[model samples]
Target: MNAPFPPAADVGVPVEQPMLVEDADAVAWDQSTDLLVVGLGGAGLAAALEGIERGLSVIAVDRYACGGSTAANGGVFYAGGGTTIQREAGEDDSPEAMLDYLRIEAGKVVSDETLRRFVEQSPETVDWILRHGGKLAASVWKEKCSYPPLDRFLYHPDNSLVASYRARAKPAARGHRAFGRDGKKAWGLGKFITEPMTQSALRLGLVFHRYSEARQLVVDRDGRVVGARILSTPEGSPEARRFAKYIARANMLLAALPPSIPLASITIALGNHYLRKASEIEAKARFSRLIRAREGVVLSAGGFIMNPAMVRRYAPAYATGMPNGTLGDQGSGILLGMSAGGATALMDKVSAWRFINPPKAWAQAIAVDRAGERFVDETVYGATMGEHIVDYRGGVAWLIYDKSLREAAFRQARDPKLVPFQRDVTLLNLLFNARKAPTLDALARRIGVDAEGLVRTVATYNAAARGEAQDPFGKEAVDMHPIERGPFYAMDISIDSRFLPLPVITFGGLRVAEESGQVLDRAGKPIAGLYAAGRTAVGLASQTYVSGLSFADCFFSGRRAARHAARANV
Candidate 1:
C-alpha cells in the first residue's frame, strides 16, 4: 500500500464555517409543518421560501451548510429569453415558444405542460431573485440550448473581470449596482448568496435545520409516504433536542441507510481531506445506498457524489466501453438516483468533466501546440479555446507537427507566460522549477504518443491547413488543429470538468404533472401527497443548457410544490 500523501498546508481564505448541533433528548412537539424539505441547496431554499409565502410551515434540512454547490459556483444565472435571446436578437419569444424549446430540448422526456409552466414562471422567478436583493447585469447574452441551429436562447448576468472591478468599487450602500454604468458582466463569485437565502427563509417563518442527514423515507403499509427518518447526531445542545422532537412528532420512519461513499477527494474538497477519515467516507457511502428503494425515496442529494455502478445501470450511455481515460473511473450521484427508483430517460453519452482554476503548464502547452499550426481562423480558435479547455478529454493530446512550421508560431508568442489565466502557473512556478523542453518530439514522448506517427500526422494536417478548412476531425469544435511544427511538443495538460455533463442541477427530476408539481407513476397516475422539484424530477432541458433557466425552474417548482403540498391533505 502507498503511504498517504503529506497533507497540504492550508491557505488563508475566508469561508463560512459549518454549524454543529448536539443533544437529541426533547419530547416537545412545538409545531407541525405542511412540508418537509430534505436538502437546503438552491432547490430546497427555493421551496422553503416559496412554501412560506403560500402560508405553509416548511421544514428544510441539510447535512452540510446550506451552500452545497451554490456558494462554490460562479454566480452566473442564465435565464433564457428574459434577457439574451429575446432582447438582443429581437426575436418573438413567448411562453409557448420557450416551452416548445424546452420540450424539444429534453427530447420528448418532459411533458409539454410542464415545459410551458417552466417557461411562463421563469421570468417571474428572475424577478423574485431581484426582489430579494439579488442583482443582475443589464447586458444580455445570447447562447446555446438543445434546439439545433437555433441554440441561441439564454442570458446570464454579466460576470466579466471589468464588471467585478466595477462592483468592488461601489460601496454596499447603493444596493447591488443594478448594472455597472457600463453594461458588462463579470465572472467571479458575486456575493454570499447561500447565507442571505437562509436568512431570508428563516425571516419568512420557514424552519431550517443543518447537520441533519436524511437516511430514508417512512412509508405506511399501503406505500404512502408518512415522513422521513433522519439519522442525526446529538452534538449536544438545546436546539438539537427541539429538532429531534420535531422529527419524532412527524412520525417519520427511516427508509434506508445511506450507502454511497466518497472514493477519492474531488478537487474542491481536496484542501480538507486530512479531516475526513475512512469512517466518515464510509458513512456517506452508506447513506448513498438508500436511493435504490421503490417507494417514497427521493434522492435530493447533490449529483457530485454519485456511484459509478449506478451510473452504468441508470445512465449506461456514459459507461459504455468508451476506452479508459475517456471517462473518469469513479462515479457518485448516478447510483443515488437509480437506486431510488428514478429513471434516467436521456441516458446517452454525456461527458463528465469540470473546469476550475486552469493549471499553468496547460496555458504553455496550448500555446506551444498551437504555435505554427496554420488551420482555421486563429481568432475563432482563440475565442472558443475556453470551451475546449473546459471539456478536455485527458490531461494530454498529440501536437502533430512537421519540423518547420512550429518555429514560426513559437516566435510570435515567445513567452508562454503571456496568457492571462496563468494563476495556476504562477503557483506552479513558486513550487517547482520545471523547465520547458526545446523540442516537440521530446514533449510528445513525455506525454505518451507514437513519436514517429505524430510527426507524419502533423505533416498531413499542415498540408490540409493550407486548404480553407483543416482536416475532417471538426478541428474548430474540438480545438485540435494539426500541430505540424518542428521540434514537436506534447506537454501534459489538465482538463476542466465544468463543460461536461453535470447531473447535479439536473433538468429532469420527479415526473410531476405540469400544473400541480405532483409526482406520477409509470401509468401517469398521480401519487398521493408525493411531489418532486429540482434535480429530483427529470426532464427540463436536453443536449444543451440555457444557464439560469434551471435555477428559475427550481424556484418556480419549489414555489409550486409548496402550494400543492399545502393543499394535499386539505
Candidate 2:
C-alpha cells in the first residue's frame, strides 16, 4: 500500500531518503524513507527528528504511541551538574571535570571517550530540545541525587557550563530530587506533562503511530536487520507482512538486539511483590548504600504508574493489552535492536530507581526492609528502585526504622497511588484501606497467604533484628537492629507485579556505538546502520544521569544516528 503523501522530493522539493529499502517480505511495508525507526520512545523520537532535520525520508513507529518514555516520565531532564559541583567545592566546573566524574563513576565500565562524548553533546541536546519545544526547569541541587548529584571529586578544565542548565531550562524548573521536601532545584512530571515537548516534536512535522508495536526485526541469514514487524499492542492484531517487507527493502540492513541485561536487572532486582511493611525498610537500607557511594537518587514509581494512565487516555489499546513479566512495553526496542544485531551487555547492574525510595503517591505502601525486618525510611525510590524490584528468594528486603522514622515518613507514606486506585491500585489497599495490620499473621490471613509461613518469616526477621539469630536471607546490608520494640517495628509489603511493574518504563537498553549511534554486539562490533539511545542503549551507569541526561542522550544519539545513516547514503 502507498502512503497518502508522495515522496518529499516530489513536491518541488529536493529532500533525500537516506536508507530507503525495497523488500516485499515485511508486514506493513514502506520502502521510500531513507531512515526507518522502530521504536518511538525517547530514542525513536530523537532519531526521527534528526532524520527530518537532515531531510531524509523518515518513517518511525512504536508498538505504542510516540511519547514512549517522555509521556511516561516525570519530565525530568538532566545534565552532569559539573558546574554546580565545582562551585560548591570552590573549584571550576569544566567539561573535563564532568568527564572525570563520569570516569570515576563508570569505574572502567565505559570508555573515557564515550564519557567525553556524552558530556560534550549534552549542551547541544538540551539546546535542541529547548529550541524545538521541550520545556525545562532547573535548580542548583547539592545533595546526592541521581548518580551522586554532581560529585566534585573529579575536575574538568572548563567551568562555564557547569550550572548553565539551571539558567538554560525554562520556568517552573525543579531540582532533580524535588520529590522530597528538601529538594533544591528541578522540575516534576506534573509540570512536564503540561509542557510542549511532544507538541514541539509534532510541530516539527514528527508523526506518531500509537498502539503500534514492533514485534521482531526482519533479518537475513547474514544477521543484518532489515526492518521490524509491528503489532498495534500486545493483544492487538499484528501488522501485515507487507509492511515489514517494505521497511526491510527500503533501509540498509542494520543490527538488532535486546536490552542489556543490566537494564533488565533494574526490574528484576525489585522483588515482584512489594510488601508494605518490610519493603520500605529494604528500600531505605539500599538507598543509604547508594548514598554512601555518592550516587544519585530519583523517584520513578509515580512515573511508572502514571504513564500508563496517560497512555490509556492518549492511546487506549496500547495502554492495556501488552504481555506481562518483562519490564516496559515487552521491550520491543530491545527485541528490535537484538534482531538487528545490536549488542546487549551490562546485565549485572540495574538502574537506581527501585532503591532510591518510593514516590509520594506510593510512598505509604513502600516499606523498607532492614535485614529481614521491615522499617520505614525515605518516601521515594530514585534510580536504585530498579535493582530493588527484582525477584529474590522469599521475596525479602529490609526497612530500617528509628525514633525519627515514623515521624518523618508516616504521614507521607499514606499518600494515594498515582494511578486510579481501583483499576491499577492493589487489591490489598482496596480491601484493607491501605492500613498496616498489627502482625504478619493478621496481614497474611488478610492477603490469603500461608499464615504459618508468614508468622515464621516475621519471627525470624524479628530474631535477626534482635541479634537472637541469623536472618535466613543472610541480609547483611540491613541497618536497623531488633524489631522487638513497638515504635521501631518494620512492616513488609509484598510488591505486587501486576500494578507496580505494569509501567516500569524502558531504560538502559542495547549498547550502541557512540559516534554513529549504531547498535553494537556483545563483542562491540557495530550492527551496521542500526543505532539506539535512551533506555534502549546500555551503560546508563557509565555516567551520572544528572538533570537532563536522559533527554539529552535521546536527542544526541538520535541526531548522530540520522546523520551517520544519511552520510552512509553518500
**Per-model TM-score versus the true fold:** 0.57, 0.52
Please list the Cα RMSD from the true structure of every candidate, rounded to 1 decimal place.
13.0, 16.3
Candidate 1 local Cα displacement, residue 117, angstroms: 3.8
Reference-based lDDT, each prediction: 0.39, 0.40
Q: Give me the candidate number with maximum lDDT.
A: 2
The residue-by-residue lDDT of candidate 2 on 130-233, one tens digit each, is 56655443324332222222211221211112232223322211122212211322122313432365565567666554434344444434444455443442
- Candidate 1: misplaced stretches above 4 Å? 1-31, 84-113, 139-191, 233-299, 304-351, 354-422, 425-467, 470-484, 491-525, 541-553, 566-570
- How well is each residue in 1-570 modelled by candidate 1, as lDDT tens digits? 111111112211111121111311121223345677766666567777777776677776666445444333334344443433244444334554444444533436556666666666665666677656564543323221111111111232221111222233221100111221111212123234445666778888976656556544544444344445454443345544444343333211110111111222242133223223322532443222111111222234443223244344334433321111101112212222222232333433233321211231222123223232322222121212322322333222222223343343334234432333223323332223222345645654565555565455455554554555545432332323444444443322223111121222222234556676555554566654455665555435333343333444455656776777665535
TM-score computed on alpha carbons, candidate 1: 0.57
